[model samples]
Target: MKFLQWITLTCTVLIVSCTSLFCNMAYVTNEGSNTISVINTATNTVAATIIVGATPIIVAITPDGKTAYVANGGSNTVSVINTATNTVTATIGVGSNPTILAITPDGKTAYVINRNDNSVSAINLATNTVTATIGVGVSPFFLTITPDGKTAYVTNEDSNTVSVINIATNTIITTLAVGTLPRFIAITPNGTTAYVTNENSNTVSVINTATNLVTASIGVGIKPFDIAITPDGKTAYVTNLDSDTVSAINTATNSVSVTIGVSGSRPKLLEITPDGKTVYLAYEDISFVTAINTATNLVTDTIEVGPAPAVLAITPDSKTVYVPNSDNNTVSVIDTATNRVVATIGVGSQPLAITITSNPQPPHSLAGKKKKDIFATQTDRINVITWSAPSEGISPVRYKIYRDAALTNLAGMVSASNALKFEDHNRKNHTVYSYYIVSEDLNGGLSTAASISIS
Candidate 1:
């Protein structure tokens, strides 16, 4: 059996939000200021700002969540941010105009897309240096690693192709011709297929990973540029920029199943919560972000944000989402439950990308395997939490829970209780509350922390 290489939580302190657990340190790249804003999600504000290269466009977190690599388009370098200190510890030169980055699952390397040179730079994470530069097609923008970390697929915008790279050898094994102006790419959870969004063609090319071939091209709305796939890999969501809409593609058939309109023009980026319950998209023209319910495929809430909200990234616990406003020089924090702007943080000028990276749990441990289905409902003055039990290891002896980011006080001290649910009395309707759950085994072993936010 393959064992997980668990790293000491000392590498970096970037916030990683997902189903893995919880992280408070997330990083945002500011295009205008040439720096990265370190966001403390617990406070929904910018905690620190670290200077990097010029026009840093994309950031990638190592799988271990200890370090973040920022691609500087103007400086032709990559800045390594150590999460622990929120500082730029190292700078490695790469090809000119690096736009995107993808780290392998093992957290050992990062693949950077250099648009000007039409190549991908493989950086050694431990050494903080570039190991190899593999040539791809024209203007490569985005890349995604497979679940197994064996292969990487990069989207080339100008050549309209997807280059498949063998991670072991750091070489381009093959390139599959895709749609016009392919910009964003996503691989399914099962690692069977990859979906590339074509902006000019307004279509998404579904590629069979085994054969490295484009198996299907599904028509979306006008100018489909970005995409987000569900955790189960059952569906793919594409943001149609020109149409001001989002196309929901059913991955089973590779067809457009639903089209949800945005609040304003230029629906640039979209992301699904870790639970796969809601989809959030940023509207550049209207200065707003819209939240859509996956069940009914209807707009649930519309939040006013800074100018040109370009990217959406959610925390691991599905509690908070950060949207970088390109023109306003700010980042908007959205409370997932309330679907409102809880905080407006002044980042560097023209922040374009937001990335959350955290120290993840072991692959199959009680904490890693205990990804829970957390649900919250607010009725009048009370907020109730309901969740399925942890699936791995022994049943928890009792569930201990806390409210807010800081474990200030016990919500209700019901020790050794078997109740799978709890109700927080007297919670305001619009007040966002963060909860952390600890599952203690019979031998007094406290499992990894599971968290959620209720409003």
Candidate 2:
């Protein structure tokens, strides 16, 4: 499975280009109505409409497709929706104007961009709570993590800089200055380079991943609002909102090879299909989407969608396109083969953003375990801890070991494939350490912690 990464352009304008492996459902966030429209992709109909916080601008689904985190710009809260139940299970309060959220590849943590407060909240997926908050530059909006899940790059609009964060510690390692008003960012498939769009400077800053420095600044159209790289990482397409054009940049040379003029007034946001065959551009002023052929760099078809189509999401198979229309309070489903609208489903009022689940399956019920056991032994300087899964409940997929009795300090974790064992190397020879073990499943369910003491 391809690692799911978060891509955000701005609070008002953003695009999520994810390679969902088994995507079968689409979740659209309605800004005006403060609700979510869940569309079953197989049936092309609204299966459920869930009410969220006020002015929900963006929504991100976990890689497992079991949970979704919605950023409420108006209420300064993130609504966690359980995909299986189609309901908001928890409402997490974050910084002011929480506009974007990015989940880690393991589905264990989520980092939310609080634009108004200029901070990022790291949420623990297991507990559905904020674990840490890291401060960043002024008016930060754009965020994208590296492919390896080790680093995250954030664009600060007012500061004109990019904050590089270490994923494990959730701290800022460095902040590199970029062009003025960096709005959108894209990292290559190889995790070697990152391309950031400067809205005010009318250029894109290319950064070296190894050095974390601005290596080159390539000039583009009037105002580059959003950017998307092809799956192959050979070319990156940038949408120029003011110039009404799309600039194709060659990744190898870091130069503009071709500039394609778009028909609409403001070509605001765009997304390249996962198959790398087509690029769809959404216009802010017009009611249609212009499809561009990546092979020829030419406009292929202009399909009319609902009025004010704010964002677009293409399915993993590249067979369908889903666009959320903010003005009409509906979603337009387009069949990719024919480039036509197959169905228009009514949703909440003013849908601003949409994200489809990669594997939208029904929720599995996991019974609680009644008994579990853990044993620890000292070998050299390492405390080797092993546990036995309770025979009372369903089979567990992984185990988490905590050092503190509060279970807040994580000691180590071992997957079921790792023989259900964890080694703690930070043990002191003369001190007694209390360890807690919790068994977990793929659906984010945790068993009661079993305690053990080692001296």
Candidate 3:
């Protein structure tokens, strides 16, 4: 039998709370309603509607997932929401017409882009106040925080330039000229490169973040509005509003790798799944979310959502997708596994951007275990091993041993109570055999380690 078939099955349960067994919540900023929407991922429902400020154009969640900050363009203030309570805990006054926001990795600071002011506001999370404002190029619309949270890159919409800000000092370190009307920015996972979407030029500028310079320019679709980098940092996805398509950029050569067409009229926002296998694009006019296969660069599914789906966000597990509909004042939740809309949650008007907190998966304890003791008879045959289990209730006492990475030995879960041993008889006498073990919970959460080598 295949390894996937041998795993035990468990009932899937949905839980809604501040602290979910899985990180399953969505934060949406509403521009028309002047508020933000908090959605429960499990139920695909709106838990709360928070009144933030005027024209909340974009929203960003802190790295720790404890708080969400919304940039209100009309009011020039950022509304801080406590994710646990789904309430606005504070209102931080920032620069004029804050259009986008980015938070530091430590979750202690935030950078807000002031479109009209042409400045970035640095907010101290602890005090919920703006500590400094750094001037940049014209119409700084979007900002991206580096992985290390030491710097922020802002895309100047009108100036066709990118500003690099030193987060620690709250100062503009340098500015690099790029394509016309840069609208969105994203940094690679390794923090080595940054990608900027040029709306007017219909291209993306690849910047070397270390030198704060544009290294290359890749032509994409018409009017690229938003951008996201794959988890591996090898590819980037950009949403083209005018062309109703998504452009995939290969980071290695800094060029357009592929383009996936969408059904909707204007594809405004884009997000990538945690596993980096799927990309989600939100269509603003038709109110739909299109799921694209990253490997194939094709639209695999389209999910009907609320009116004017403006933004999209995916949960840490990549099992759920949340979309904010600006026209209908609602948020739609899509179960990725089923490729269907599970629920439509009503919220404030004109929901603009959405983000989710990532839940931590249980650590694999077997990672540090010695291979020789774990697998004596079965080693050298397997190249890879994987284990997964559920996230809650009834701790898995132990795991079953298997020969081969595919677990083709010992039919099913054997009692680990007996020194967690498994033997291999199918292998030749002189041939090497490899073995592996996996621990899982009742909820289908599994943890896996390396394979054991034996001769």
Residue-level lDDT for 260 in candidate 2: 99
lDDT of 3 at 378: 46
Q: What is the lDDT of residue 402 in candidate 2?
A: 72
By lDDT, who's the top model here? 2
Scored by CA lDDT, what does every candidate get? 0.77, 0.82, 0.72
For residue 401, model 2's alpha carbon misses the true position, in angstroms, by 38
Q: Write the per-residue lDDT of candidate 1 for residues 1-455, one digit (tens) a residue.
A: 22222212111111222222433577899998898998776666677889999999888876545578898999999998877677888999999898888888778889888889999999988888889999999878888899889999988888888889999999888989888999989889899999999899888998998888888989999999889898878889888888888998999989999998767788877899987999988875778888989878898998888888887889867778898888888888898989988888988889998987543331121111111222354233445555555543334456656653344455753344554666666555455566666654332334355566553
lDDT of 2 at 291: 94
Tell me the lDDT of candidate 2: 0.82
Ranking by lDDT: 2, 1, 3
Model 1 ranges off by over 4 Å: 1-23, 362-455
lDDT of 2 by residue, 286-315 (tens): 999999999999998999999999889998
lDDT of 3 by residue, 104-177 (tens): 87778888888788888888888998899899999877788888888888888788888888887998898899
Q: Tell me which of candidates 2 and 3 scores higher on lDDT.
A: 2
